[model samples]
Target chain A: MSHDAHVYSKSQTEYEYTRRVRREAMRGQVTTFAIMIFLTLIAFSAVAAGFSEYFIVPILLLLAAIQVVLQLYYFMHMSEKNHGMAAFFLYSGAILGFTLFLTFLTIVWWN
Target chain B: MDFNTKYTPQSWPDHPEQVTLEGKNKFLGFWLFLAGETVLFSSLFATYLALKNKGPSGMEFSTQTLFELPLVFVMTMILLTSSLTSVYAMYHMKNHNFKGMQTWLAITVILGIAFLCLEIYEFNHYVHLGFTYGQSAFSTAFFTLVGTHGLHVAIGLGWIILLLIRNAKRGFSLYNAPKYYTASLYWHFIDVVWVFIFTVVYLMGVVG
Candidate 1:
């Protein structure tokens, strides 16, 4: 099976173009990292500022959700092609996780 | 080609990590494992949330008095930056720049070690303050959840460091490309879990 593989060298132009594209993608990843940092700052400051728990909790969760989405899509390359099965598995786990959260938060805390 | 196949920048596949059947299977299998990790962590988070702050009748060690924001904030930034460094490493990997990739990964390992040191210090401080793992349900839950994440960080560091050493002379190949790719993905996933730990565990713990 290994012998079936073929290696094709790119032309100079093709190599340069791919390099440029990857650099741009790397730049996008940096932007995502910046946004994640901004979100973390907001989360920390909102608590440090002494906001009501009711108001802060939802905002914190929302910010965390947004940050995770960015991490998964940009950093983890879920935004790229050929991730349908990957998405399916992760989302299925996520759905079940959400269910676990709901159940535990409700049932376990009951007096 | 096989592991020993040599290629120049011009010959390197665009997605060298996914260029082979083995690489493709590894890619898919790793994601499946990550999905399982998600479920496992969610169970832990749920348990932590349900048991948070619940203890004996006169428990005084609540989240408000226990968690320190500045420390957590620093840890968060370190882990987040480490995630980006791994991204940079992957970028170099894609560009077929072996030295660049190794340098960035080394930077990532240093950051990860820094983060792990902070966590150890934080846990030691907690233990010193009578908040040992057996102190209360809250303490137990807190330690378990956060400690589990710390373990992941440790494992990730070991994995990347091993890869760096093993591939030092290997240069780049379809075989090792997928290994590096999956390791970075694991590192990013660690950062993803930290985002929640900071928000739900530390930030919200402070608010209440």
Candidate 2:
């Protein structure tokens, strides 16, 4: 290759270092996913078997909320660097979501 | 608290500066994606709760004959396991174990395929029993909520197929690393959605 070409490639390649390293394992996240699924299915089966109606929705609420946290921290990599910035968007979305759901719930249920 | 400590060096590139940009982007981007999913499921949940009993001609379609604990339970297992398999794929991708990554991705794909098949059968049974979408509000919400989830699975399947094919040769480059990671992220997201669906749609409906 020409000297100029080599120079250009060298500069570019400086950033082109090893791409796939060890960080992507994400085992912690995946394992959490597995456990949530297992527990959720157990709950699903139990409810399908017939349960007191009042307990079903509340228990599901707990499970769903917990799973959301797991997805955020684990799958979505929310705990990584720049998490503060990420959390800004995430918390904004969460607050907005809860507000929306609660607003609707109040309008529909309390009314 | 440092992101670097959270993962092994192999989980990322060797030259840390090369990845800082992408990691930051991903951190925000994936959260935005989750926001959108929240709206999607919330809408489905609202619609289902609203129309769960609105049947045509006063016939009042029901799910008693449509859903079975055993089949849904099986599907739940399949999808959940696929999430684990995807994690393994990501793990290998970080390690730069190209062959191992491919193997795990294939496993995830197979599990996803199995789940989709069971879901198809479940929907078929529902339709056969006159509990189809057009039959009642209940069916409409049921199909739309659950069907949306099914559609996500289908999309996920297509995603992995493309990833598997694309990465077959190139292996795990930085370019490809994020692709697989995001796909797995999506897989877990949809699986999380299913946890709700199984509860609110199948379990809650039946128990109620």
Candidate whose DockQ is highest: 1
Instruction: Compose the digit string of candidate 2's lDDT tens values, residues A1-111.
Output: 011211111233443343322333354565676778766766876686667778677887787778767766776566666567667865666676656666655666565
lDDT by residue (B1-208, candidate 2, tens digit) is 1222233333445422225457446645876886777776776777677666657665746655456777877887787778778777766665557899899989999999999999998888777877766877678778888999999999999999998997688755545566677788788888878877877777776776
Task: Report the lDDT tens digits of candidate 1 across residue range A1-111.
Answer: 355757888899998999999889888888898999999898888888998889889999999999999999999999999999899989998999989988988898675
Model 1 C-alpha lDDT per residue in residues B1-208, reported as the tens digit of each score = 8777888989998888888889999999999999998998898899999999988889879998888899999999999999999999999998889999999999999999999999999999989988899988888999999999999999999999999999899899988999999999999999989998988899888888
Q: Scoring each candidate complex against the real one, what DockQ results?
A: 0.81, 0.24
Error of 2 at B189 (Å): 0.8
- Model 1 C-alpha lDDT versus the unseen true structure: 0.92
Off by over 4 Å in 1: A2-5
Q: All models: lDDT?
A: 0.92, 0.70
TM-score (2 decimals) of chain A in model 2:
0.68
